[model samples]
Target chain A: MAVDDAVRTALEREVGVEHEELLGEISATLTRRYAAAVGDSDPLYHDAAYAKSLGYANVVAPANFLPGVICWSEGAPYDRLREDGTEADTHLPGVPAKGVRVMGGGEEMHFTRPVVAGTVVSRRTVLLDVTPRDSKQGLMLVARYQDEYVDERGQELLRSVRTVLLR
Target chain B: MTTPSDLRVGSALAAQTNDTSITQVFRYSAATWNTHRIHYDKEYALKEGYPDVLVQSHLHGAFLTKYCTDWAGRAARLTDLSLRVRRFAVAGETLSIAGTVRAVRAGEERRALVDLDLVETRGSDGETCVEASATVEVPRSWIGEGVLP
Candidate 1:
């Protein structure tokens, strides 16, 4: 069998495992930068006074802000990085850290509560399933991961089922 | 505020456009801690057959989210957002988004759920790069008579 197929088999074996991570706090500066980067001038992400007027304790992260954060850790050394410039340990639960290329397919998200600055968040991610397919890029696997985000108090902020394409 | 009177099934929302720049794409990747070189390395993007560094899929989703949130404002909350990237949009491409109301139903308490169908099109070729849907929860008072229970 090809190495890619073998990798798929290994990935398939890890289906149903749960991975959790404490993503630290959502900083106001981070949220502001994200909103600015996206060219979103929404005052809720920038002005605390405006957010307060809206009944929030402080500025709030925009919709999709939680899932948009790709890496939570400080990251590995440069030498440990893949040719694609991504760190293995930071993502892709089952697949080997090297060789495989990963791409974001899409996302289905539900916002249960607003995420405000200074809120420490945690995520429980489960590999819901993985299916192999043949694409224009040749053999690939589509994996769906359901990520549940909660506040320090365990209140659900949001949940998203993210689709990742591995080649 | 996207009041109930503003959300009618089949009614079209105003269109908004964003002229994407390479700087914007790189900044988004950096802010997200996404080290993917395809979003910053022009050479790598060319080797991958793209005209230039491509926009991240999540960026496409963000545009859709902005579209909904900008329209809804503070009076409404975006409860749900789902999107699929249908094509790759290179840097410097203009992304235009517009939505139409799909349905309205009673939500929790005095809130009403407004569903919208959104499409993000690339201005360079008029091709749709992403298709999305959103559910915004708004005050039921904004709904017109007989629109919802």
Candidate 2:
């Protein structure tokens, strides 16, 4: 898609729509797998007793494991993949910004509390905002998505603001 | 509840480097469901004001985590993590993330809280592309645990 067309489509589209993502319960296996992938051997993330001593009833999730918490609800995989064969959402299926490459500019994470094992989480997402930057190359688009994580009782566990830079 | 105090300020920690490749960035984008084109499409990235497919912000943060943990060693838990992307990270750029101890505290129990000034620099330019700060929990006996010994 042309860069201008893509930009217009994103701007005209509804932004800031609230989405309730049922992330289901925390899984020890997933945590262990992530820890292993990251080459982490922290006992608090693997041993229940160690975690309990730290005031956690079960294993704690890794700081970057937020992607595993939600099943991003959106379109098919193939359609969302960019021309270079990379998916759009990074973790879940979502709208395709074919011409644009989204760079995870970084995130501001507020861990209100620890996510213990077996507690189901609900991630609420809001599109937040989209700003366009006209650079020397052409046009740059900044997309920000805000994800709020809550428990069964509606207590905020974590809030993440993810910003991505696209063309 | 342990606050942000109790950590030694002005101390130093070891720095770490990661030889990041386009393939790794592609896989990260795939696994994370990130579909931003600047990450893998060099043509697109160039057209959008970058030299190549830029690294994701979270990936940069991940590099910071590696730098801290490499120095803190095992038995460390990131009690709090906060990062702001100051610039872009392009592909084929080898980034070395390093940190200096900012503060330390007596965290929840047997945990020493630490804060650091995190930085990511490109080998080619020798300039820090991203600057961040994070709070992590390390065991009080971390140095004696053969991690820093």
Candidate 3:
């Protein structure tokens, strides 16, 4: 399935429109689990005392922790899932819930501050742009989404621009 | 660990290797709440043209993230990272990450910002699977003057 006119129109309409979600508080356990999953044994990410010794309030999250997480809340029901097993209600804004295939192309991230346990976080996402390209498989649309993560006090934590390819 | 003062352009960081397994892939998917069948269901992956359950894209990012942070240690902070996946590696493939200092510049509060060009290549075919770059904030005291080459 190639990117058709409707998909292009939908994506174009979402450009610059911000979608907000509360990602909730960061937890030390979750951070540790994420680090363990990545096979990283960095003490700063696992030991609170070690983290504090290094001047952090608590164990710090890995650089890509925020963006690496796919869903923040309990995911949608089975019916709300796309054929590719992605939740239809979040992430990609204007893209249709069905028919289109989505793949992660790449991302550029700026980690402004270390995320520590007990810090409530929120994310504001905006569709940056969409470009049409031809691929061997067929027509592909490269859509870029920019996500800004902040603590409850509105202090920036991390900012990322992620590219998704739609076919 | 390579301190900032000792980090001259073209200096290579120690290489880190990760031997990925199907179980590791499954655990990563569970931890991230990712239900994408291509990461766990070999049959589904085969239908999608992959030989076996494929590694998640974020997992690749995770490995690269670990590489940078592990090298930077506790004091140095990883400020920026960018990654592009050029190829696919299935579960059970050995992935090796290595980096070289590209540039060094001054930063706030007596810190030096080091830029590194990084690459993650698969062991089986020796093809580059992911290309990346990172910026780390390290203490200026650690970076000696005239380090840039």
Candidate 4:
């Protein structure tokens, strides 16, 4: 079977199935580094004292910080990764571990609560659907994944439906 | 200090220019643990038909989020953000982002919900890289005259 067909079939079958992962805690360093990398100098993200002044126990992460992280674990061995450097074991189910080029298409996010440093996070994801369209480059498969990120206590932090384009 | 009184449907937040460098791209990739070669390996990027390393889509999200949060400051909270990547941005490019108020609606507890339309344009060709929208929840006091109508 063509690799593309296999991906499409797998994606279709995987739709509606929920996949969950424990994304670990939101650390002060992770939040700080992410904020710094974005060149954001918001004191609420930098100073614990300032955050406390605002009633937070610790620095507050930028709203999209949790989903912005591509990998929470150490990741797969180099040889086990795709040519594009993405892990074969990514949260994205159905898509082959290799032989596919994947890129983020877009994202829609709703922030339910402010995430402060030290909050443990987990995410539940499910494939929503897939559409095949001819692109200038070639055939492209567009997939959207619904994700709900929750705090350790099961309270929701944010929800997003992100689109990924694959070839 | 922009307060709630400054928001209006036709008003636009100040447009700001963000300059990205190769170093910045590398650092952002490292900070996010993104191992994509298209963002760091210039050779790989060239092979992929891009001139140089490309910017991460989430980085674009960060830029748009920053624009809204900076404008809202302490008076408002960013409740929702959505973005669609229209084009790819290469490293060392200057990106200009501008947001205009789209609508105003009443919120719970004497609050107001402000919707903003945003666009990120490339400085080199003036091409759009991403288009986004955001909703902010603000105290009713932030509403400007005619902003509700």
Identify the candidate with maximal TM-score.
Answer: 4
Error of 3 at A11 (Å): 0.9
> Looking at candidate 2, what is the lDDT of residue A1?
56
lDDT per residue as tens, model 1, A1-167: 22287887888887889998999999999999999999999898999999999899899998899999898888788876767777887757886777877778899999999999999999998888989888877888888989999999999999999898887
> Candidate 2: which docking quality band?
acceptable
For candidate 1, what is the recovered fraction of reference interface contacts? 0.80
DockQ agreement of candidate 3 with the native complex? 0.77
| Model 2: residues with Cα > 4 Å off, grouped in runs | A5-13, A47-55, A67-75, A84-98, B1-11, B19-56, B66-80, B86-94, B101-115, B123-125, B135-149
> What lDDT does candidate 1 reach at residue B111?
92
**Model 3: pairs clashing at backbone N, Cα or C within 3 Å:** B4-B143, B5-B142, B5-B143, B5-B144
lDDT by candidate, in order shown: 0.88, 0.66, 0.87, 0.91
Q: Worst 10-residue stretch by lDDT in candidate 3 chain A?
A: A82-91
Instruction: Identify the runs in model 4 with alpha carbons over 4 angstroms from their true place.
Output: A1-3
Note the DockQ of each predicted structure. Answer: 0.85, 0.29, 0.77, 0.87
**lDDT assessment of candidate 4:** 0.91
- TM-score of each candidate's B chain against the true B chain: 0.94, 0.83, 0.94, 0.94
Tell me which of candidates 2 and 3 scores higher on lDDT: 3
Q: How accurate is candidate 1 locally (lDDT)?
A: 0.88
Error of 3 at A31 (Å): 1.3
TM-score of each candidate structure, all chains considered together: 0.96, 0.69, 0.95, 0.97
Best by DockQ: 4
In CAPRI terms, model 1 is classed as high
